[model samples]
Target: MLDDITELNENTTFVEEAKTIDEEDLYPFPTSEDEPTTKRFLGMTPAQLFVISIEFFFMVLIFGVFFMIVTERMTIPF
Candidate 1:
């Protein structure tokens, strides 16, 4: 059932290779086969990153405000 869903979703898997590089060794460059040339942030464009950052900032600001309000209420005398 999961395989069917993954196939329908156009999800493909690739095998990743690991490389060992020593500092003293002259050749330390990663091979092309081991290094996958894929853009990870392709989905997150500049505008999207900006918008997400603003949204996260506002969320943190709202949470901080709520926390401060609660703390103040708890500290005040009845």
Candidate 2:
């Protein structure tokens, strides 16, 4: 019984340490120097805007398809 309790405590400690390491890796706190600077939309190049627009359109199309699927409005004909 004592061996079992010791094993359980060791397992718990290992799990807690692993969790802490994983959390640190997943979300290392950003430093102040890593912060983004404010930029105006007018500063964006035409190519950047075009890429953004395309991404937005693609996202909207994906959402539309998802909505249709979830609503059971999508159909297949054999």
Best by TM-score: 2
lDDT of 2 by residue, 1-78 (tens): 234654565545755656656545776887666666865477897789999999999999999998988898995455
**Model 2, which residues run further than 4 Å from truth?**
1-40, 76-78
- So what's the TM-score on candidate 1? 0.42
CA RMSD of each candidate after superposition: 16.6, 13.9
Candidate 1, residues 1-78: lDDT per residue as tens digits? 234544543343332111233443555676666665665475676789899999999999989878877888534445
Instruction: Please list the C-alpha lDDT of all candidates, in the order they appear.
Output: 0.63, 0.73
Residue 31 lDDT in model 1?
A: 61
